[model samples]
Target chain A: MLKDEELDLLTGLLSEKYGYDFNNYARASLKRRVGRLMAIDRFPSFAELLHKVNHDAAYLPRMVQSLTVNVTEMFRDPSVFKTIRESVLPVLGTHPLIRIWHAGCSTGEEVYSMAILLEEANLLHRSLLYATDLNPMVIENIKKGIFPMSQMKVYSENYILSGGKKDFSRYYTAKYDWAKFDENLKSRMIVATHNLVSDRSFNEFQVIFCRNVLIYFDKTLQDHVLNLFDDSLEKLGFLVLGSKENLRFSSISKKYVQSDEKEKIWRKMK
Target chain B: MAKNEMNGFKVVAIGGSAGSLETILAIVQGLPKSPGAAIIIIVHRKNDLESILANLLSFKTHLVVKEVEDKDPIYPDHIYIAPPDYHLLIEDEHSFSLDSSEKVQFSRPSIDVAFESVAEVFAGRAIGILLSGANSDGAKGLLKIRESGGYTIVQNPATADMGYMPQQAINLGAAQHVLDADALVATLNGLF
Candidate 1:
C-alpha cells in the first residue's frame, strides 16, 4: 500500500509540475500504475518516482500514456456500426455539414472505421471527423492512417458485418506487413490530443462515439466524461458505445432514448 | 500498535456479471461475520432495484450487510452491496460514490468498474475477487490489483457455476489464489 504521505506527494507533484491531475482517479489502480512505473524505472520508492516525475518533463507524459487504456479495434462491436448505418446516417445526412467526434480514440481503428462508413454512405464530403486521444503517438498514427496488414482479414470481416457496400480491400493498400489506408479517407479526419480528464468541450458534434473508454475510469471520472460528451453533442445528436457498454444508467440516460438498444445506439431526447 | 497510526483498510471488492449471486452467497457464508475488514459486493443489474442480498446473507454471518449509498464511509465488519444501475467506486477517504454512467460489459454496476476503483483506492491494501461470472469484465481490473501489490483471489474455474470469468482472470495472471469459494473465504479470513 502506498503511504498517505506518498500519495499526497505524488498527487501534488503531478498537479503542480505537470498540470495532470490523477488525484481524483481510483486510488488502487493509480497506485498500481505508479508502482509499476517505479519498479520498471528502478526507483527505490514512491517518493523517488515522484521526484523524477516532478523534475523530468518527459517522464510524466510517458507515464500518462502508459496509464491510459488504449485497447481498441476497427469496427469493434460490428452490430453498433450496422445500427449507425441504418439509423444514424439518415439523420446526419439531412444536415449540410456533419461533425463527428471520436473521443479517446485509441489506436485510431474506430476513427478509421467511422471514416469508411461515412465514405460508403456518400457523406464523406460533407462530414468532418475529429479523432482525439491523450497519447500524441496515437494521434500521429491516426494521421498516418496505417495499420498492420495481418489484421486486415478480421477487420474486413467486421466491415462486411457492419454493412459495408464496397470491397473493404479498396480502402487500404498492403505494403509489406503494413496496410496504408487511402489518403482520401484520412483527409476528412482531424486527429489531435484531447485529454478527457482535463480538457473541456471545444466543438459541438453531430455524433459522438466514446466506446470502451469509460470502463477504465472510476465513477466520478465516468460521470465527468459523460457530461463532457453530452455538452459537446448538438441537439438530437447520436451517441454510440461498445456492445458491452450502455447509457441507460447515466445522468444523461434520461435525455437520450435508445435508437437501437441492442446496438447501443442512442439519440438525444432533450 | 499505535492507535493513531494510519492503518489502511484491507478492503476486498468483488464484482460479478452473471451466475454471481450463488457464488457470492457461498463465499459470504464461509467468511466470518466480523472479519475486521470490509467487503464490497457489486452485482451487475439493469436497474436500481431494492436488494434483498444483505438480508439473505445476514442469516449466514454476523457481518452487517447493507446496500452502499453515496458518500457512505466504509466500515470494517460490514458488507456493502452496490445497488443496481450505478457504478460503485471508493474514495480516497474510503467512502463510496455511485456513478450512473454508461455501462460496461453490457451491464450497469460492472465488475471491472468496481474492481478498478478498488484497485485505485486500496492499492496494496485492496483485495480483488472474481467470482462465477460469465464474462471477462473483472480480468483486467484483477490484473491491475495484482500488479499494484494487492492480493487477488479468483474462484477456481472447476468450482465456479460459470467458469469464464475465473478462467480469464487466471489467464491474465491476476489471481494469486485460484481457490474454491469456500477456500477463498478462508484465505481472506486468514490474511489479517
Candidate 2:
C-alpha cells in the first residue's frame, strides 16, 4: 500500500497540474486506491507514478479510473432500494412528470434499478433518468447494458429482496455469456460523463442519488458536492444516498429532513 | 479518571469478530461513563444488514454510541462502531471517513481495516484491543499498532469463545496485555 506521504505528494501534484482536485479525498481511502494502482501497474514510487501521469497519456486515464473506485451492483443493499420503492416512489408518483439524476453512476446498475422500480410503480413512461459518471469507460460499458449472465442469479435475488414482483427473467435475455437487459429499460436512461469534482448540475431533479461516491472525498469536497446536490434537487424532492452516507455531518444536513433515515433517503425541506 | 492520564491516550480502537459482543458489552460497562479518548470498535459483521451494535452497546454505557457515518468528526468520550458493509477510516486526527470498498479478510467492517486506519493517524497515542473472533484479521493490524508504539491488548485465548483472532495477535507478539473480559476492562480503567 502507498504511504500517506506518497499519496499526498502525488494527489497534490495531480490537483496542481491536471485540474483533478484530490487534495480533499480522505487520506486512507485515497491511499488504498493509489496503492492498488501501484501494484496493478507496478510503479515503484509516487515520483515515477506522477511522472508517468504527466508524460504518458494512457496512464492518466488509468490513474483516474483507479482513483475513482467505481464498484457497484444492481439493487445493492436491497433493503434500501426497497425503501425507495415503498416510500419515495409513491410521493414521486403524485408529480406530473419526474426527473431523476444519478450522479457517479458507475456501470449504471442503480440507474437501471431505479428504472425498474419506476417502471413497476407505473412512473417509467413519465420519468426521465439521467446517469453520469467521471469514467468514460464505465459510461461506455453502461451504455451497452450487457452484464455477465453468471451474475443473473445473484441479481435476481437482489431484485426480489428489493420488492420486485415480476419475473426477473422477463426483464432480460440470456445470450451465450451475458445477460442483456430489456432495451426499453435502456431507453429510459441517458448515460454520460459528468465529473462530480468539476461539473455543474445540468438540470433539476425530483430525486438525486450519489450513493457511495462522496465517501471518496474529504470533508471540504463532500461539503461542496452536497451543496451541488442541494442546488439540483427541487424543493421537497427526495435524495437517496448510500446506506452508509448521511446528511448529518454536512453543512446542508439541516436543509434536508429524514424521509427514511435507515435508507439514507431524505427530502429537501427548504 | 485522572485528567493527565486520560489525556495521555487520544484514541482507543477495539477489533473483533465472532463471540465478541459479550466482551464488548463488559468493556463498555466497566469503562468510565465518558471515556477520555475517542473510541472506535470494528467487528466482522453481516455485509448487508443494518447494524444495531451501536444501539445495543449504547444501552449498556453512558457514552453516546453511534454507528459511524461518512465524515463523522471523531469526538472523544463517544463510542463509534463501524457500520455494516462500510470500512471505516480516520480521515484526519479529528474526523472519520468511510468507504464501500472491497472487503479485507473476507469481511467488510474488517477489524484490520479500522485498526490500520487508527494506526496510520493516531500511532503511539492509540490503544488497540483484539478480542474473541474466529479469524486472523486483527493480527497484522495489532502488530501495526504495536510497531507504531501504541498499546495493544488481546483477549486471553483460553477464555475466548472463539480464540483464533486473539491467538493470531498473540502469535504475532501483538499483545502488551492479554486478559479476559473483566481484566481487560480493569486495565483500561487503570490507564485513566
Candidate 3:
C-alpha cells in the first residue's frame, strides 16, 4: 500500500503532467479509480500508471474518460423538471430573450429535455440553451442528439411524470438500438467543451442547471465552482442542483435563497 | 484521521447491491435505539424518483432514517441512506460529501467508494458489513475496511438469496464473521 505522501506526489504530478487537477477531488474516490486501474489493467503500481499517463498520449484520454462520468438520463428526477416547468420557466419566459446554461450536460439528454420543456411552454422560439461539459466526447455526442433506444421507455415514463402533456415518444424516432431526437430541439442549443475547473464563465444566463456535477469536488473546489456560477448567473436567476447537492455552507449560500426547497431549486437574491 | 474521542467504534457503513434490502431491514430493525455510533447505508440505486428507501427502512428501525445530502452532519442513532446516482462519501468524521464520478462495479452509490471513505474516517474503530447481493461490488471495500483495522462481517453465503456478494467478500478473506440474518442482527446489537 502506498503512503499518503506518495498519493500526494502522484496527484500533484498528474496536474503538472496532464493539466487535470485531481488535488481537490475527494481523496478516497480518487484512490479507488486509480486502484481499480491497478487491479484490472495490471499497472502493478502507481509509478507504472503515472509513467503510462505521461508517456502515452492515447492513454491519457482513456484515463480521463474513465475518470470522468457521463451517467445521465432524460427528465431525470422528473420532479425537478416539474419545478422548472411550473415555476422557473414562467419567470424566464417573461424575459425578452431567455438564456439557459446546462453545465456538464452529458450526452445532452437533459438538454433536449429542457428544450422540449421550452418548446411545450412556447418559450423555445425565444430561448437559447447553452450546454457545456469538460468531456469533448460527450460534447460530440450532444451534437448528435441521439440516445440508446432502450432507455427511451424509461425516459418516456420520466417525461410523463415530469408533467409532459405531449406523448414522450414523439420527441424521438427510434431505429434498432438508437433514438434520434427531433432536430428542431437542437436549433436552440449550443454544445461545447467548457471545463468548469479551468475555464471562466462565458455568458451570464437566466438559469443554470449544473446538477450532479459539483459533488466530486473537495470543499475548496466546490466553493470555487459555486462562485463561478454566482458570477455567471443574472440577479434573481434560477440555479438547480443534483438531488443530494446543496449550497448550504458554500461561500455564496447567502446570495441564493432556496426557492423550491424540495426540488433543489434556488433563486439568486438581489 | 479525524479525532476519535468516542473510542473509534463510532461509525458503521453497510454496503450492498441486489437482494440485500430485506436483510438490511432486519439489521436496522434489530439494532438498539439511539446507538452511540452513526449508521450509514449505501445501496446501488439509479431511480430519479423520490427515494422511499429511507422511508421504508425507518418503518422497521427504531432510528430516524434520512436521505443523505452533501455536508450532512453525522449523528448518533440516525440512519443515513445514500440517494440514487450520487456516490456517498465522508468529508470528515463530522460530515459527508456526495459525488457524481464514474460508477464502479457498474453502479453508483458504490459500496467500495463509501466503505473506503468510512475506513479512512473511522479507522480501526469502524465496522463494515457486506450483505447479500448478486454482484461483487463490496468485496474489495470489505477488504479495505479490514485492512484499515476495522471489524468486518458478511452475511452467511449459504443463507443468502444472492450469495455472490457475501461469498466474494469471504473468499477475499474480508470477513471476521460470516453469520446468518439472526446471528448478524445479534452481532450488530452486541457491537454498538
Candidate 4:
C-alpha cells in the first residue's frame, strides 16, 4: 500500500504535470485504489510507481482510472430510479426541452438507464442527456452503448424493480457476450469529458445525476461539487445522489428539499 | 461490567449471516444503553428495502441506531447497520464511506471489507465480533483485527445457530475469546 506522504507526492506530481487535481479526494479510498493499482501493475515499491507515472505519460490514464471508483451498474439502487421514473420524470415533462446532466457518468450505464425511462415516459424526443466524465475512455464506451452480457441479468432485475414494464432485454441486442443498447437512445445524448474538480458547469439543467461521485471527494471538494450542481440546476429542478450520499450536509442543502425522504432525489426549492 | 475496558475503542464491528439475526438481537438487548463505542453490524442481506432490520435492532437497544449512509460520521454510543447492496468501509478514524464495489464472499457489505477497513483505521482501538453464520467472510478480517492488536471474539461454535462462521475464525486463530451467548454478554459488559 502507498504511504500517506507517497500518495500526497504522487497527487502533487499529477497535478503539476497533468493538471489533475486529486489533492482534495478522500484519502482512504484513493490510497487503497492506488495501492491496488501498484499491486496489479507489479510495482515493487512506491518509488517504482512514482517513476513510472512521472516518466510515462501513457500511464497517466490508467493511473486515473484505477484511482477513481467506477463500479456502477444499470438502474443501480432501483428505488432511486423508480422515484425518478414516478416522481421526477412527470415534473421534467412539463419543460419544452428537458435538459438532464449526468455528472461523472462512468461507463454510461445510468445515463442509458435514464434514457430508457424517458423513452417509456414518451419524453425521449424532447429531452437531451448530457453525459460527462473525467475519463475519455469511458466517454467512448458511452458512445458504443455496449455493456457486458453477464451484467444484463442483474440490470434486468434492477430494471424490473425500478417499475420498468417493458422486457428489459428489448433495450439491447445481444452480440455474443456483449449487450449493445438501442442506437436511438444514444441519439439524444451529448457525451463529453468534463472534470468536476476543475471544470465549470456548462449549462443549466432540469435534473442532474451525480450519484456516488462525491463520496470519493473530501468535504471541501464535496461542497465545491455540490455548489456546482446548485449553479447548474434550474429552480424546481431535481438533483439526485447515490443511495447513501447527502445534499443535506452541504451549503446548498437549504435551497433543496428532498423530493422523496426515502430516496436521494432532491428538488431545488429556491 | 468489564469496567470500561472498551472505552478507548472507537469501533465495534460485528459480522454474521444466516441464523445470526437472533444472536444480534440478543447481543443488542444485552448491551448497556451506552457502550462507549460505535457498533457496526454487517449481516448478509438479499433485499435492498429492509430498513426493517435497523428498526428491529433499534427496538432492542437504547443506543441510537440507523442504517449507515455514505460519509456518515462514527460516534460513540451509536449503532450503525450496514445498508443492503453496498459495502460499508471505514473511510478513516472518524467516518465511513459506502461502496457499490464487487461483492466479497458473494456478499456486499461483506464482513471482510468492513473488518479489514476497521483494522486499518482503528488498529488497536477496534473490536471484532464474529457470530453465527455459514460463510467464511469474517475469518480473515477477524485475523486482521487481531494482528493489528485489537480484540476479537467469536461465538462458541457449539452454541451458535450455525457454527461455520465462528468455527472458521477459530480455525484461523482469529478470536481471543470463544464464548456462548450468555458468556459473550458477560464478557462484553465486562469491557464496559
Candidate 5:
C-alpha cells in the first residue's frame, strides 16, 4: 500500500517540477500508470520514480502520453455522425469556411471519419480539419492516414450505418494488410500535438470533437478541458462526444444544450 | 474510531461486477460512520438504466453516499458511486469526470479505467479494493496501485460472492490484504 506521504510526494513533484498536475485524477488509474512507469524504468520505489520524473524533462512527456487514454476508432458510435448529418451539417453548410477541431484525437481514425463525412456532405472543399493529440506516435499515424485492412470492413459498416452515401471501398486502397486512405481525404486534415491538461487553445472552431478523452481525466481536468473547448468554439458551435458521454454533470453542462441526447451531441447555448 | 494519522484523505477505490452488492453492503455496514477518506465505487453495467446502488448503499451506511457527477469534489466520509455506462476518472483537483468512450473490458464504468485513473491521480494515497467481479479487468489496475505504493485489498475468494476477481487480484501479487469481507472491514478500521 502506498503511504499518504508517497502520494503527496508524487503529486507535488509532478506539479512543482514537471507542471503535469495529476494531483486530482482518479487515484487508482494514477497509481497504475505510475507503477507501470516504475517497472519499465526499473525503479525500486515510487519515491525514486518521482525523483527521476521530476529531474528528467523527457520523462514527463512520455509519462503524460502513457497516462492519457488513446483508444479510438473511425465512425465510432455511428449514430453520432447520423445526428451530425441530420442536425448540425445544415447549419455548417451555411458557412463559407469551416474549421473543425478534433481534440485529443487518438490514432487518427476519428479524424479520417470526420473527413469522409465532410466529403460526402460536399463540405470538404470548404473545410479545414485540425486533429491534435498529446502522443506524437498517434499523430504520425494520422499523417499517414493508413489503417489495418482487416478493420476496414467494420469501419465501412459503421460509415454506412452513419448514413454514408458513397461506396466505402472507394475511400481506400488495400496494400497487403494496410488500407491507405485516399489522399484526397488526408489533404483536408492537419494533425498536431496539443495537451488538454497544460496547453493553451490555439484557434477558433465551428465544431470540436473531443470524444472519450475526458473520461481518463479526473473532474478538474475535465472542467479545464471543457472550458478550453468552450473558449475555442465559435458562438453556437457544435460539440460532439462519445456515445456514452454527456454534458449533464459537468459545471459547464448548463452552457451547452443537448442537440441529440441519444447521439451525445451538444450545441453551445447562445 | 481513531483518525488516520495521515493528513490527507486516504481513498479506497472499489471495483466490482457480479455479486458485488451484498459484499459491498457488508463491508460498508461494518465501517464506522466516518472513515478517514472518501470511498469511490465503480460498478460495471449496461448504459441505459438508472443506478440505485448509491441509494441502496446509503441505506446501509452512515457515510454520505451519492452518485458522482462531473467535478463533484472529493471529500472524506462520503461514498461516491460511478453512474452507469460512463468511466469515472479522478482529477488533479480531486473531482470526478465520466468518460463515455469505447468500453474497456467490454463494460462501461470499467474497473480498469477507474482503477487506472485513480492510480494516476492519487498514486500511493489511493487504496484499491477488488471484490466480486467475473473478469480480470481489475487485476492489472490493482497491480498498478500496488506499484505506486498504494495499499491494495482483495476479498478472500472463499469469502467473496464470486471468487474470480479477488482470486485474480491475488494471483497478480498486488493485494496487501486478502481477508474475508468481514475480516477485511475490521482490518481497514484498524489502519485508521
Candidate 6:
C-alpha cells in the first residue's frame, strides 16, 4: 500500500503533469485505489509506480481509469427509477423540452435506462439526455451503447422492477456476448467528458443525476460540486443523488426540498 | 464503560451471511447498553428496496441501530448497518461514504470491502468478527484486519450455522480467537 506521504507526492505529480485536481478526493478510498493499481500493474515499489506515472504519457488514461470508480449498471437501485417514473416524469413532461444531465455518468447504463423510461413515457423525442463522465473511455462506451450480454439478465430484471411495461429485450439486440442497445435511444443523448472538480456547468438542466460521485470527494469538493449543480439547475429543477447521499446538511439545503422522504430526489424550491 | 473507553479498540466490524443473523442476535442481546465502540454490520442481503434488517436488529439492542447513510458520522455505542446495493466505506476517521460502483465477490455489501476499509482507517484500534456464512467473502478481509495489527475473531466452524465463512478464515489463519456464540459474547463484553 502507498504510504500517506507517497500518495501525496503521487497526487501532486498528477496535478502538476496532467492538470487534474485530485487533492480534494477522499484520502482513504484514493489510497486503496492507488494501492490496487500498483498491485494489478505489478509495480514493485511506490517509487517505481511514481516513475512510471511521471514518464509514461500513454499510461495516464489507465491511471485515471483505475483511480475513478466506473462501476455502474442499468436501472441500478430500481426503487429510485420507479420514483422517477411515477413522480419525477410527470413534472418534467410539462416542459416542452426536457433537458436531463447525468453528471458523472459511468458507461451510460443509467443514461440508457433513462432513455428507456422517456421512451416508455412517450417523451423521448422531446428529451435530451446529457451524459458526462471524467473518464473518456467510459464516454466512448456511451457512444457505442454496447454492454456485456451477461448483464442483460440483471438489467432486464431491473427494468421490470422499475415498472418497465414493454419487453426489455426489445431495446437491445444480442450479438455474441454483448448487448447493443437500439440506436434510437442513443439518438437523443449528447455525450461529453466533464470533470466535476474544475469544470463549470455549461447548460441549465431540469434534472441532474450525480449519484455516487460526490462520495469520493471531500466535504469542500462536495460543497463545490453541489453549488455547481445548484447554479446549473433551474428553479424547481430536480437534483438526484445516490441512495445514501443527502442535501440536507449542505449550504444549498435551504434552497431545495426532497421529493420524497425515502427517495434521494431533491427539488430546487427557489 | 469507562475502562473500555480507554481500550485500544474503537470499532467492531462484523461480517456475516446466510445463517449468521441468529448469531448476531445472540451477540446483540448479550451486549450492554454501552459497547464503548461503534458496531458496523455488513451482511449479504438481496437488492431489495425495503430491507427490514435494521429494524429487526434494533429490536435486539439498546444501541441506536439504523441503515447507514452517506457521510454519517461514526460514534461509540451506535450500530450502523450497510445499506442495500451500496458498498459502505469509511471516508476517514470520522464518517462513512457509500459507493454504488461495482460489486465485489458478487455482493455489493461485500464483507471484504468494509473490512479492508476498517483496517485502513482504524488499524490497531479495529476488531473484526467473521460469523456464519456460506461464501468466502470475509476470509481475506479478516486476514487484512489481522495484518493491519487489529484483532480478528471467527466463529468456530463447529458452532457456525453454515461454517464455510469462519472455516475459510480459520484456514487462512485469520482468526485471533476461534469462538462459539457464548464465548464470543464473553470476549466482546470483556472488551467493553
Report, for all candidates in order, the number of backbone clashes. Answer: 11, 0, 1, 5, 33, 0
Error of 2 at A139 (Å): 1.7
- Scanning candidate 5 chain A in windows of ten residues, the lowest lDDT window is A25-34
Candidate 2, residues A1-270, lDDT tens digits: the string is 467677777877787777777888777798878877888889887778878987877677778888887778899889988898888888899998899999999888888889899989889989999999988888887788888888888889999999998888898889999988888887878888998888897999999999999888877888899999999999998888887777777899998898864668889999
- Provide the lDDT at B163 for model 1: 93
TM-score comparison, 3 vs 4, better candidate: 4
Name the weakest run of 10 consecutive residues (lDDT summed) in model 4 chain A.
A27-36
Candidate 3 on A113-158: residue-level lDDT in tens? 9999999999999999999987777788888888999898899899
- TM-score of structure candidate 1: 0.64
**Could you tell which candidate, 1 or 4, scores higher by DockQ?**
4
Which candidate model has the greater lDDT, 4 or 5? 4
CA shift of B18, model 6, Å: 1.6
Model 1: fraction of the reference interface contacts it also forms: 0.08
lDDT of model 1, residue A92: 90
lDDT per residue (tens digit) for residues A140-187 in model 5: 899898899999888988899899978899999999999999999988
Model 6 per-residue lDDT tens digits across residues A14-39: 99999878999977678878988998
**Candidate with the larger lDDT of 2 and 5:** 2
DockQ, cand. 2: 0.61
Query: Would you list the C-alpha lDDT of every candidate in the order shown?
Result: 0.78, 0.85, 0.84, 0.89, 0.79, 0.89
A136 Cα displacement, candidate 6 (Å): 0.9
- Distance (Å) between predicted and true CA of A229, model 1? 2.5
Q: Kindly report which residue pairs in candidate 3 clash with one another.
A: B8-B125
lDDT, candidate 4, A58-138, per-residue tens:
999998888887788999888889988888888888899999999999899999999999999999999999999999877
Using DockQ as the yardstick, the better of models 1 and 2 is 2
Question: Candidate 4 on B44-83: residue-level lDDT in tens?
Answer: 9886557889889888888999899878988989999999
Candidate 5, residues B25-132: lDDT per residue as tens digits?
887888776687888888876543554787788789888987875556788888988887567777543577665555778887788878877776677678898988
- Identify the candidate with maximal TM-score: 6
- Docking class of predicted structure 4: medium
Where is model 2 chain B poorest over a 10-residue stretch in terms of lDDT? B1-10
